[model samples]
Target: MNEITLPPVSEIDWSTWVPEQVATLMFILRNDEVLLIRKKRGLGAGKINGPGGRIEGDETPEECAIRETNEELLINPINTRFGGELFFHAEDMPRIHVHIYVATDFEGTPSETDEAIPIWFKLDQLPFDEMWDDDRIWLGHVLQGGTVEGYFTFIEERLIDQQVIFN
Candidate 1:
């Protein structure tokens, strides 16, 4: 038997090392509003984002997205479509990648849950200023029907440089 040796902490770029599998709901509300949440934990906790969570167990990312939305905001993600993936890399965390999604429809009214507070925002009223800085750079591009995969270098939680491959 062989033991798998993990990389030394000193070799891991903690500043940019954040590998995550995340699903984001693009729940379009009745009045051209988008359902968003104030996350309670993780990378974007306390900032506005769509309902989602890390992929767990044998569940696929799509399943995780729907389950997370239900668990976090008590909403049923209906007519959900796989919007595709987002791959991000940073120099601080050189060995991890992020997978992101955008879903289209959902059921039930948005409400606050222990993990998040769901709210509806008009299409033009997105609160980009209160979110992670990288969001403003790519989130809009994703919502606008573009596919994205990129690498970024961050220092002290601030992005210093990025390279995106959009399709």
Candidate 2:
């Protein structure tokens, strides 16, 4: 048998550790309206969300945000800024770490795509009832021009426990 030595636990920077799948979300907002999409397929199908998707190899979160926006909305997202991070854990699914960004500068009008249908709503008129369980709890903060960090736990699409903080 061979023996291996490991570094002290304190030497590890666990705070920066990331799970297998990394995702990015970008929200485009104007004075009183924010653009959203009705997802047609994939996780949270039929739910309303900002355009986003899994990050590909070697792609930065910001890069992933731009790519996802273009793919889903056919628009070029500009002046994007990192807004927050979300940690989601589900009993039957892999944990997901999402990097969220807010973009107010963009070109072209949004249109429906194979993945989702573009929609706009007055900020105060957002349809929280038709979004992911955690959205109603935390998304409002993001819409209010604040940063948010959330650790959410879910069981089969139902939120079990969550702690959301806004800056």
Candidate 3:
């Protein structure tokens, strides 16, 4: 009889498994146009979405939003207000804990960033067809100035399912 051999189990790297804290700003133009980014890479690459990024050390969510806006869009969001918050999880990617904000006023004109390109479109004309599948589920409502919460499941960057509750 031949003996069977199996590979030994390796311990997981907790650091690499830690969930990331992300922040974003939803800049609403006077014409109900919302600021979106065409990501240069990753799951939503080439897709239209919001302007924001990860929360750096010692920075609050609001601060992160402000910083990200300047860094990613070259604009200083004014009178920015908290709109909503979302917590997304999937087995394939790092957990995303995001805070959403709405800015009706800003200091500088919007511009592109290394990671994203800033673009504007009428709210009613949002290109859902070019955005992440999950955006169509919760983003529209959020832009209407409502608070919402949801859990999204994705399989290899494709949204498989989501459960959302609006307030």
Candidate 4:
């Protein structure tokens, strides 16, 4: 098998880089359990992730977060608050900037949709192996009430480099 080669992270000028698309990721935390989803379609199809999607016309990141969660899980996030931001740079695909939110409560019950399948996991037992590589690096911080800013570089679906700052 031919080995996959990736460009050095330094080659990408992050200082002036801008994301082509803006999105959101919302997680509902109740006690020790966090709600996640098995995405059935879209960019990260087949990966386990928070419920979120691209920002629709004129909607703010927070609004998009709430809207997407309701659409994908049939629930409305309550007491939602901004948690962090993530910047992704992937080879050949548009760069993306994601706003992260955490909710302490939610209205309605989580149900499966064409877009995703809702799943809840204990805080200490997140299935990182089935999630985006960058998730494992910064998700713990968010769960612990810490805010973060993460920059990730990917070559197709492979994570090649990352940096995260907790504040």
Candidate 5:
């Protein structure tokens, strides 16, 4: 596999790097179905994941989550709660801090956008095999009303080590 080519971890100043390419991801759940997207372009394209993207300057993670949702899925996520955080340490990609959220509801119907195709799956039927490897680390916990925080390091897309906490 071709590696993502991120800056070396040792050079990353995590204390101040949270503003660098910070991202937000939102999962909207209803009944037993969870909304996901099959990205059509950019990072993680062709993979199954929730709707989200980079945080613009002066925008909070929550704002980014709502904005990305409206852009990608044409819905305004409602009752979004901060779920956890993911710190990415990878060789191929730059260090990233991603804020995660779970939306108990949303406004408008999900429609496909230029960036992704929205899809839904049963809570017990998530496509783990088609998502980022780290999804297996915290997805289930947050989906079940629990919270999660994960720090994952990778080399060439292969998981190197992981630390996760759930409550």
Candidate 6:
């Protein structure tokens, strides 16, 4: 297979970058465990990640987060709060901006759905190996209640560069 070529990270103008998709990622935290999903379809299919997707027309990021959680895991996330924002630029696709939220409570049980399967993991034992490379770099800070902003560049599925800032 031919390798895809991407512009170097330093050559991209982050200040003027526009995302083709605006998305949300909602993490449901309960005491020592956090809810994650094994995505079965769409963008990151087969990857383990938070429940989220592209935002619909006029929907606020928080609203999108709750809705996506319900749609993907059959649960309605409650007490959701903004956690951070992530900017992803991949060689083969348009840039994506993801707003992250953390929810402390939820209603209904998490169940398997067409798009994902719900799983709960300990805060300190997140399945980073089964997740995107960037998850390992910044997820810990978010779990510890630090707001973060990250910029990541990828060549297809492999991370090539990143910058993460905790607020």
Best by lDDT: 4
lDDT of 1 by residue, 53-156 (tens): 66778887777778888898887777665554544444343333555666566677767887898777777778888765666777666666676765555644
Give the candidates in order of lDDT, highest first.
4, 6, 5, 2, 3, 1
Q: Which prediction has the highest TM-score against the true structure? A: 6
Model 6 regions lying over 4 Å from their true place = 1-3
Between candidates 2 and 6, the one scoring higher on TM-score is 6
RMSD per candidate (Å) reads: 7.3, 7.1, 7.4, 2.0, 3.3, 1.3
On the 0 to 100 scale, the lDDT of residue 19 in model 4 is: 91
Per-candidate clash tally:
6, 0, 0, 0, 5, 0
**Cα RMSD for candidate 4?**
2.0
lDDT of each: 0.65, 0.84, 0.73, 0.92, 0.87, 0.91
Candidate 5 lDDT, 30-90, residue by residue in tens: 9999999999998788999999999998999999999999999999999989899988887
Query: CA lDDT of 67 in candidate 4?
Result: 99
**Candidate 4 local lDDT, 67-138, one digit each (tens):** 999999999999988999999987556689999999999999999999999999999999999999899999
Model 3 lDDT, residue 113, Cα: 72
lDDT of 2 by residue, 47-165 (tens): 99999999998999999999999999999889888889998765466679899999988998788899989999999999988888899887878877788988776667777777777
Model 6 over residues 82-129: C-alpha lDDT tens digits?
899999988687689999999999999999999999999999899999
Sorting all predicted structures by TM-score, with the top scorer first, yields 6, 4, 5, 2, 3, 1
Candidate 6, residue 27: Cα displacement in angstroms equals 0.4
Indicate whether candidate 2 or candidate 5 has the larger lDDT.
5
Q: What value of lDDT does candidate 1 attain over all alpha carbons?
A: 0.65
By summed lDDT, which 10 consecutive residues of candidate 1 come out lowest? 1-10
